[model samples]
Target chain A: AEGEESMAAPADKRPISTIVIIIAMQAEALPLVSKFRLSELPDSVFPKGVPWVRYYGIYKDMNINIIWPGKDTVLGVDSVGTISASLAKGACIGDVFLASDVAFHDRRIPIPVFDLYGVGLRQAFSAPNLSKELNLKVGKLSTGDSLDMCPQDEASLTANDATLKDMEGAAVAYVADLLNVPTIFVKAVTDIVDGEKPTAEEFLQNLAAVTAALDQAVTQVVDFIAGKCLSDL
Target chain B: AEGEESMAAPADKRPISTIVIIIAMQAEALPLVSKFRLSELPDSVFPKGVPWVRYYGIYKDMNINIIWPGKDTVLGVDSVGTISASLAKGACIGDVFLASDVAFHDRRIPIPVFDLYGVGLRQAFSAPNLSKELNLKVGKLSTGDSLDMCPQDEASLTANDATLKDMEGAAVAYVADLLNVPTIFVKAVTDIVDGEKPTAEEFLQNLAAVTAALDQAVTQVVDFIAGKCLSDL
Candidate 1:
């Protein structure tokens, strides 16, 4: 199983000294950025034309990296996966990843997913006790090709017992699979897919309302990162 | 009545040419910040010892300012209001404000509110046709002093036909009331208070999932601002 792969990291490898927070957009990174007062890494530091950009800082004496892939899961498998795999190739056993994003499934319901469900990679690696310790509601998450909050799409996903739907988490997991690292998700419910027909332009309308809550969740995730990975720092 | 106040300003007044995006934390401002690539306003710009801080920039040729009052509506009436009213005293007739935040109302149901509900400000100003054009579900928003997502609290709110609950929107309205400025809420549901004894730590557990949606909603808000206020720009 993928969980065991992380546990069995060879003694000769680096002992996983970093914690990465990957998000789809800058907003998701703000709370952490401000909370840690993170400084933006200069463009000159990265090789030109890289598909992703990151902010680096120290929090609680731990090295924390926050990355935003240029876009969402639309590029997760192809671009994000490749980049993540390369960065994680030499990552140690305790290296942690907390992938965050917005999702839809139930009607006007906000559900937190701690466990990931995908087509393959049943051997997916998850954080040792992040969900259990947080006492959050864990459920199966199905990643789709596009935003799936419409009534018709909701009905289809619900029929299969998939309570959560997203665009990029699975792809991120694919990258984790390639690197044999442990990852967990910290998602917030933005809207319930009732019969309302939402256009791409209207997608983020409710974001302001839910941001206060997202700030709190990200804070918890940071707390968890400090607890589990501070030893490496 | 309030709508008339903002709509009937004298031609010589400041003319309300600015659009302010008010929120509690940096996360809520993420989508808008990145979409506009807003720059932080230095503390020296505002009169010294202000209770809140703001970021300002130009989006689509309109003067856009995003403010975070250090916290939520908990300070809206007292601190946020005094500061906002002072700023709006010279604001123009057509200026717009898009109030954003996470809210909880019914038990386990996240509902969006397009209409502002309070003791009196019934004819309050609204974005010309933004909500109707978008076909969003509009309803009454009841603001309280604390987080109202608790089980017993939710039952009481539903009994009053309150579709949404927030800590800051109504309070922001109080500030708008003082300055006679038009404001609308673009809120998203973050949690359903259905018997889920959510402690302070657990309030934002599901935020990551919903942030993407919130991001989309905020983007739309920015677009609306561009369309409605660009003439002023």
Candidate 2:
């Protein structure tokens, strides 16, 4: 209930009609594309030669678009949006977690007032009822572009009290916030950042199973979101 | 006339009313802030703890907002936006240049189709008349976070045919594109990327004079942009 006040419906109270799912990997996007029966739009939908891919379809009353921002790993968030989902580190494999908040671990602006800006913290949209109904783990998510954790990043992560770590979540949150759109993060854990096993090996090994779990959890989230305004979540 | 087709006014044809100038350094922002006779708002305009600074005032009919995005080197682009100006490498000191196009030199997605996405290329809003009127140099801009260029970055910049190098222009262009806002870039050269002197020395030596030159050029740009729609630029 800490963030419940901020969850009050906006003045417009428009019903959610369009849903965009931003996926970072082809492997993750493939399952959702098939499950949602999304048709791939032509490459021409984007400017010439950009590798971004868009898949769209109507699921019930919701218009759904799944975007894959190619292999370069930057997310282009152009959705009338909500829900930035991705695979996270620092949790058990296949555990589904909902972000309570998001911040950056790699960006450090050490100036007195600017230190806060360096972290770029943002709250995830509150969804208490839905979170309780699904029994999802809820905690802070930290992001950086690097897969390997440096000591400074570790310090930043500790400072942020981050329970989930990913390369893309905060970037998506920043964009979503800029658009005045509320966002909830649904992340599936694929590898433990501090575990003895190699990150790439564990990640690749668990990616498939985690992707399936994530897909199921997200589908339920979408179902819960249907026929509701943002505050309803 | 090459990019003229994309310059047609939108159906709504709303007259431009708000102008946001995103400056990375406080030194760069000070002169413009003084010239525009802007007042700094309380830090509370942004979320608590973020160090981003905003100075605003009416310049003629335009509501001008100049933002300094803290010391962390990350740009939080929250504006009903336009011009993204910054300092550049690869041109003579105090030379003001206008970006014809922008791209990232560091993001390389090597997959066959994804390679194009790796470049993240975008056109600067067409402004031939303004460029001609100001006698500004017009060329491609390549961006990356690092000031020190690697061999791969060099190759990419060459491939991009970059005439200027900076840390933030392409990113601003990317965000502006997502918002369907056209962006034109005006850059002042401080250090040559491949020049003989150490970059830091050259940059420090030239920054004050260059900032002055940049401030003048941008003031003229803002003046030219007044009383016009985006297409008019």
Candidate 3:
């Protein structure tokens, strides 16, 4: 609650004791970042002064900021700490949205792809008292800057039992878990991941579906969050 | 080093020491339990039949058995700590390999192409003492798995800045960084991250070059190990 004390009297331009850490694997990635900030939502989350409105457009009601660690988990972890610490963002409210391909699409790596999202989900869902199934299976949305050819990765996914493979997804999960956030992974299948023609065309074909999936998943969590928030109210 | 205490002990099938917490990412991956056997390294480093191996594959040393956390830094951290703390493995030597995607390729996620291997290298290399030009990149090495497009990954390696990406590479690096082990990510890029064909095809094309690069990189470190081993003798 002291977090509120410091933010309530903010001298400069910062939020009121609440901040969210949205980790983008690659900072230049616009597509992935746009998903979290659903434009059609009640109010646009896009900041007014930011010039990259077209590029950065924000997600609604989410106090999120982005950082690109360029694909290093250790550094990514450090970056998470640094970014939040720099913004003086509190660990109490720093939620992360991971951006990467392997995270949302299953079977990108040779090892059991199942464990890829499993670890993240397990860590996120296993946090204290939380519903394991319904909240996780449907509400947790996976985000990725790109997609994969599912058919190609499915075999590996089957082999490894992975649901998604986004570059930044796990890193975000790992960090958020460490910081203790009700981390939600909004994963959308961008590619078949079968290793066939995993191209922009493939991504475009799946974009809207994945985006819709992310949108629905985020909203689904509203039920759970509302319940939790109601307790506070 | 407490490792020296168990160094002379004979390998036994019986369990000894205490506390065995296996942080297996894949429940189905339980087969790894039977497949791996500790004590390939040295007795002092590990206890009885903990049945483990580093990262992947089997142990040739028979001195210690370690089930290396395959990928994902959190699990890697969890497993290493579990093993290190457990009486079974004891606090001996922590051998971990941060293996990730060696092949750099873009997966078509719903909206764009996400590069799977971009963050591993960055995570692995973005620390204090690791260097690619000097081939002295970060901490230790334990069992190795390279990206099939290993050669391509090496070719595409961009260290102009700090951290880069690889699949399992940095996961291991994180553990090593924590445990203070000199790590080597012997990754062979099976394919380039930006490729458009079967990773196998790219693997075929780049394997030779990748192997050479890996061999050279590994040899430099391996030679260092050999030199240390020889000096001790």
Considering every candidate listed, which one attains the maximal TM-score?
A: 2
lDDT of 2 by residue, B1-233 (tens): 01123365653265677888888877888899999999999854675445678999999888999888654334433211111222334456778899999997765434334456557799988988899988999989988644445566678888998888887888888767755566788888877878877655676677788888999999999998888776666
Error of 1 at A35 (Å): 50
Candidate 3, residues A1-233, lDDT tens digits: the string is 01223434342233212234353323223344454452322232443221122223243443334333333333222121111100011111112232222233232333343234333444343322223423333223232222332343334434434544444554565445444444444444444433345444554455455545444544444333432431221
Please, what is the TM-score per model? 0.36, 0.58, 0.33
Taking the tens digit of each residue's C-alpha lDDT, what string does model 1 give over B44-163? 344333445677888777777777654322222222211110000222211223333212222121122211111222233554466655544455554433342334344535554455
True contacts kept of each: 0.00, 0.03, 0.18
Write down the lDDT that model 2 would get: 0.72
Q: What are the per-residue Cα lDDT tens digits for candidate 2 across A3-93?
A: 2233566533656778888887777888999998999987446754456789999997899888886543354322111122323344578
Docking quality category of candidate 1 according to DockQ thresholds: incorrect
Using Cα atoms, each model's DockQ against the true complex is 0.01, 0.10, 0.09
TM-score of chain A of 2: 0.85
Q: Number of clashes in every candidate structure? A: 30, 0, 115
Worst 10 residues of 2 chain B by lDDT: B77-86
Summing lDDT over every window of 10 consecutive residues in candidate 3 chain B, give the lowest-scoring window.
B81-90
Single out the weakest 10-residue window by summed lDDT for candidate 1 chain A.
A80-89
Which residue ranges in model 2 land beyond 4 Å of their true spot?
A1-15, A42-50, A71-90, B1-166, B169-210, B213-233
Q: Rank the candidates by DockQ, best first.
A: 2, 3, 1
